[model samples]
Target chain A: MFDVLTRILRTGICSEPLPRIETEQAANLQQRIWAVLGRALCIRQVDAGSCNGCELELHALNNPYYNLEGAGIKFVASPRHADLLLVTGPVSVNMEEALLRAYEAVPHPKLVVALGDCAACGGIFGESYATRGGVSRVLPVDRVVNGCPPAPPDILRAILEAAQGKRQALAAATAT
Target chain B: MAEFNATPDFSGAFANAGALPSNVPCRLIETSREQWLRVAEALRAAEGMLLALWGHDERDGGQGFLVYASYLTAQGLLVARLCLRNGDERFPSLARLFPCAVRMERALHDLLGVASDQDDERGWLRHFGWPREFFPLRGENRLQTSFPPTPEPYPFVSVEGEGVHEIAVGPIHAGIIEPGHFRFSVVGEKVLRLEERLGYTHKGAAKRFQTLSLAAGHRLAARLCGDSSVAYAWAYCAALEALSATVVPPRALWLRALALEHERLANHLGDLGALGNDAGFAVGLTQFSRLKEDLLRLNQAALGARYLFNFVQPGGVECDLDPKWATDLPRFYSHLDTELEQMRSIYDEHAGLQDRFRGAGVLSTATARRLGALGLAARASAIPLDLRVDYAIAPYDRMRTKIVTQDAGDVAARVVVRFQECLEAMRLCQRLLEQLPSGDIHSAPRVAPSGALATGIIEGWRGPVMVALQAGPSQSIRHCHVHDPSWQNWPLLEYAILGNIVPDFPLINKSFNLAYSGQDG
Candidate 1:
């Protein structure tokens, strides 16, 4: 216990600071959402159909470097309790209905962020005999983080952008 | 004792089994369909491990469907091929002799329209995604783009009793994990039975493989399972290299081994921490996750990819480690060693953690062997089978790997195995870096002749991952079967959770951490 405490003290707030949003519109929207929600955002992650590369990056958000929870963002177990839905991978045909049901279960005005290349434009495993393409094929995705597996910072930015209602601008910027 | 040669004559064992000269790790034998069961039985009786069973369509060439099963024996690897005459897709099922062949046979039936004579003919990989007539891997089926609407619910065997309540958990889980359905028949937290219905993540990987050249297939193979990307890529590359008779440089082989050990290290550290967190200790999760992140960042800086996906390619690796990074790797290991030692001490001293870990989910040795438990799970149960030692290839043959085992076969045993393996992997990385050779990193890609077959097997962190490759015209993949250790280990989880409380399921499951995507593909 002493070792852990001392180690934390030595490290002294090592979490990476949030990257600056280029657009004034995105910045203002983020500030407004923080003001309205008082800095707390609950997210529920759904794996529509993934190779688990995206999931690994998402899990790193909880690590000390990202410290997503320290920034008042928490991952919840149920979509009913979540304000945002984070979906990963191209929507497999078997998971299409389940993804839709999860979207329906979340409360109204739910923001959905698609993480990774697979969830963005179906990446390599495109619309095929077994897949229904990206998350947009099943749910209305507000933002799409691009990468085979997006880095933790990219994923964090997408979540924040989704919460701030600047998902369109975020998606447009990432698309290039 | 019989002398074990690299390639032995199987003609003496079976009358009609004709040996074919193929560029594979195993000796290829062509036999009639009637002789398949006899050969399989003979191999099993010789204590051969059934590595993979798959089938492919040959109707375009008028050769009908071909079923192949590969086995590993003391005499080395042996692959038996049998043709279903005149486009008749039915073949005798080897599942009766080898229980591990059950799912593979069903998968062949589902994807390739190959029929097995097994009693249980239910679709394995076909999870209502495509129509019954549309076999995805066959050359005839056109790939559909749209979604299937509201497929029928899978049939889970019902347990009718007075306090028998059923709990259905996910194709969408509560945690940030892959999608897999688990049905539990429980009476007040004590699980009577657990049935896993996976294949929700099936993306028709085999069909996709058929569309790519052998070089592009390595990328798809790496993505088959994220955590074991190195293993899959290396195995795929090995298979291609063997088929084309391309010898990878000694330095490239050493670097591949280093990358593989690093992959194992990252996964083991993450799993150890996750297991601790599942046992209700947040300290393990925090410390271990931090360690894992640091390692991943290091990997990113050194190898250009955090997951090491595109590093291993056909003939050789894509990137080579520079001298500076090579020297710094050992320093990184020392730092990690100190931190891991501290964490191990804490885990050992904590009584609550031990109570939750020990004896929670006990898988007896008898049950493990009977169910074909594999990799770390099998080692934890004293099975003592590791492909690195049993089927050594390249660098692994020179570097003697220490096999760790625990006879208890419980959660504690699994944890200990991970810790020990992590240390061993660290040692291996250090040795590989120290003995780093200066040579060309990759050899030129060689075009394999058409109608060639090769097999590559690697002991991935989870267990032995096997890739069987068959070349087609213009260097395209005719049929590539990527088999995960989960194919043999997933069934054992049902028995492992027989009497454990439902709450401990997460911890026990994390210990094994079988890949749903790998198995689904």
Candidate 2:
């Protein structure tokens, strides 16, 4: 609930009277902040063994139109330098232990966002003889961006949400 | 014929290798379960590479479970089916010959409740949180949650040294990638050895397929590996048609080829961009990504799905090409020509990318052959194992093809192979489109027999995709294993990452771009 409230505040949803900065940012400065954050993020992606659909869209994120790097976000090669984990595929029996180890490899204060329905719910590989059906089965999932393979922008939104720490389910909320 | 586009020849290679007997009626030959070790040795001596090992638990009468070892020889493919009687379900392990066979054996044990008497003590496919002894692939009635207690940390091989530091990375990573664990034995930044622990996403796709109809199973096949949707669908349908002795109309075959070429082009474009990004060429990333997007948009216009899902069915394709795009392809071809040339120049000019990609992650021809590396990895390294030329499948048999090869056997070589294939695929697509005949898109296939089994192999972008289907009593699928080339490559990746610095691992990995779900399935 608190996180929800925070998100609302971040979006300037609850500021009825509206602070000057909030209104201005909400009205016309969204792109400015996005541009700033875009250049600042360095992303890392994990396949866990997906069919390459989500990775395709993730590839599309770098297309001239979205120009993910122009926004300032770059796809890093190693988890050591990464801020987020982009996981695709339904977790499989062969990959479960590997997934956990990779999660532990990333430094502290890292984010994990499951991309596509397979990573979110195992998608079509669900109930198969060889898979666990979702990324959450192997690790504590932070946010799930669902689609067969989610559109690139939706993936960007999920990453943005994680960067802002909105995907964290707080202890207070859990305790309540 | 263009020298660059000239295909390689593999005639009489298998026969010369003596992998197959002079006369074998069926594609498969039966042998006792106990002969597995002897068969492995014999096949190895005969120059046959182990393709895959699959387990089936349908006890015919009291005859017990059947396990199959698929071997690819120079002449023709051969399968050795080993039958284990009901009470004795143990088989000798083949890990000694093929180091990768260990995991496939464990997968069979985990899914079918069978065990290898010679299996290494380390637990494999069962490491996922699934209940022990549940054996999800078995026809036995039981819930997945009701199996025995979970085992503690599985025993993985350990390396020890004074300067060797152990760097463990992911089943969940810090990137938008698949979950996999790699234990890197490193000194400073140089990696000595890398061991992978996967199976985090082990949904029982092969097992669940039993409940689906042939039509429904086609959908499952397409979903087996999302990026290789067309490949899986075609492979599965090909198996179905072959089993039913049904012939697909010429137009459907033409359409299937078209879908495949597009699929290949889309993936090559996307992977090229990712590879460029890995090498720190942001320009390459932007340019190639844009090109891929345009291609996918064209796909969306041609087929309903940008990824081309639900496009290929059992008998043929789900739909036909829009006449406009069919007519407008020349313009698309023009755009691709310009973009590819530009991208090629960027790659050629970028020294950093070349430095990182060229010598790094070199899987030599000897090692590649030992592991039976498939697809571009094999071709780029001079293994010369393309199914298009060797197996001579439908449209490919009728049409001319150039198998792109490079002897570098490194990241750069793999990238070069993909880029070159992009041009070849475009040419093939044009040939297919121009030659499409007028005919029905599909045909009603003959229903399968209860105990019958069939398999199909298609040359997907990643490499050879194999699908095995077994029919149950009610004509439902008994078991289906949608084997992706990743299974063969992931183990090789573990070896490829060795001797390179830890930081360069991602670029080496992206260069191959093996499918995660394909392996997980």
Candidate 3:
């Protein structure tokens, strides 16, 4: 215990602050979110058909560097308790119905964030004999963070923006 | 040709038992339907491991359904192909002899409409969403079709007794993990039995492979399991190069080895940290996760992607290692070694953590062998089988790779094996960086002729990942089967969970860390 404590003291505060949102609108929207929820956000993640790559990055959000929970955004076990649904992968046919059920289970005004390229635009594994294209093809996605597997900061930003209800604006900005 | 030693007279059953296409290490034996079971039995008797079993539709020609099984032996690999004539879809099931053949046979039944004599006829890979009549991978139903949203409760096996209850978890799990259902039959937290139902992430990767060009197939292969992207891409490229009869540059082989080692290091670090966290040590999680992030950031800087996807292409790697990476990697390893040593000591000194880890999930060697467990899981059980050492292809053949094994077959054993492997991978990366040859990183591969078939087997971080490719006319892929070691290791998870408390399942499962997407694909 003494060793652990000394090690901690030596390491000092290695915890980095959450990354800043670049866009002014998204930053303003995150401030509005702070006003409404006061930094507490419960998220539930659903894997529609991902390759587990996105899940790896999502798990990294909990690391000391990103420390998503430190920002008061926690991933809950059940959809019923969540305020946001962070969906990944290109909705596989097998998981489409389950994704829908999860979306419906969440309370009203729940924000849905589509993560990774697969969830955004189907990525490489497009609508096929086994998939129903992207997450938008099945459920309404408020925010889309695009990357094969988006970096943790990008995912965190998208979650914050979605909580602020700036998904449409964020999408419009990315479009331009 | 090596003389036939142990068999039920191969000369009578096979039309041709010699001369496989380029790059396939196995000898192709075309067999009649009657001779299929006898050959499979003889091979199993000789202790040959059933590597893969897949089906192909040859109805366009006069032949009906073609089924092939590849077996790995000490001598080498042997592939047996059985042809079922028109109107005959059933074949003798090898699952009765080799228990691992059950899932693969079921997959063939789902994709190509082939029937195994001993099959339960229940849906395996094909979920309720897919129509029963439509066989997706067959030539006739190759095109995309709209699937109806049919949500059916899977028929999980039930255990009935006084106070014997069943706990069902997932398709969607609590933590940020892949989707798979686990049905545990427990008597007050002591697990009686555990059954895993996967395939929630099946994305028609095999069917999609048929639509892609040989070059594009590598991208799809890399995505088959994202964590082992480099291994899968290398295997795909190896298969393509073999089909095209193209030899990758020496420098390319060394670079590929370096990337593979980095992947191994990153995954092992992540798993070690997760295991520590599961044992109630958050310090391990924080430290290891930070280290993993640093490694990923290094990968992004050097390879252009955090996961190193699409960095390995046909005939060689897609890009050369940056000179900066060459300088930074050795320095990074030196720093990592010191920190990792301190962390290891901390973990060792923690009595509570050791108690949680030592004997939690014990998979005996007998059980692991019976279930055909592969990769780190197998190594933990003292099954000394590693493709890099046994198969020894390209750079691995030259490197003095050390095979690590632990006899305990428990969570502690798995942890130790992972630590040893991570250290070895670090040493390997340093070696590859220092001894990298001077040459081209890529060579433009020639187009493979139609009907060409090749196989690539790489010892990925998890285990031996196998890719078998058959080229169509005009350089398109006719079929590509990407097999992950998870297929062999997943069954062992059920056995590992037995008698352990429900809470420790995550820790045990993370120790194995089988890829759901790879298996579902």
Best by DockQ: 3
Query: Which residue pairs clash in candidate 3?
Result: none
lDDT of 2 by residue, A1-176 (tens): 34324423443411122112312322223344354344355566877657667777886776666656654467887767766777777765565555565677777656788889888987766634355668887777788999876766677666655655621333223467
Residue lDDT tens for model 2, B1-521: 01111212223223322222111112555665445565677677776777778887757456688888877766556666777885677887887887667778877887787787664655565673566656777667432332222547765677788887788877655556655677888999999888887665556666668767765787878876777999898888876776666778888888888888889998898889888888776656656767778788788777767887688887778888777766788679767976687668667766777888889898898888788788877887887777777777778877788899999889989998998999999888887777778879887777776666677888899888877776666657767777788878887887778889999998998888776567766
* lDDT tens digits by residue: candidate 1, B376-434: 99999998988888777778877799999999999999999998898899998988888
lDDT of every model, 2 decimals:
0.83, 0.71, 0.84
Over 4 Å off, model 2 = A1-51, A68-115, A119-122, A126-146, A153-176, B1-26, B117-119, B141-151
Fnat of the models, one by one? 0.73, 0.64, 0.71
TM-score of each: 0.94, 0.82, 0.95
For model 2, how big is the CA root-mean-square deviation? 9.2
What value does DockQ give for candidate 2? Answer: 0.30
Model 3 chain B lowest lDDT segment of ten: B7-16
Interface RMSD of 1: 1.7
Q: Residue B148's C-alpha lDDT in candidate 1?
A: 60
| Cα displacement (Å) at residue B397, model 3 | 1.0
Model 1 docking grade? medium
Q: Report the TM-score of candidate 3, chain B only.
A: 0.96
Where is the poorest 10-residue window by lDDT in model 1 chain B? Answer: B1-10
- CA shift at B49, candidate 1, in angstroms? 1.9
Better of 1 and 3 by DockQ: 3
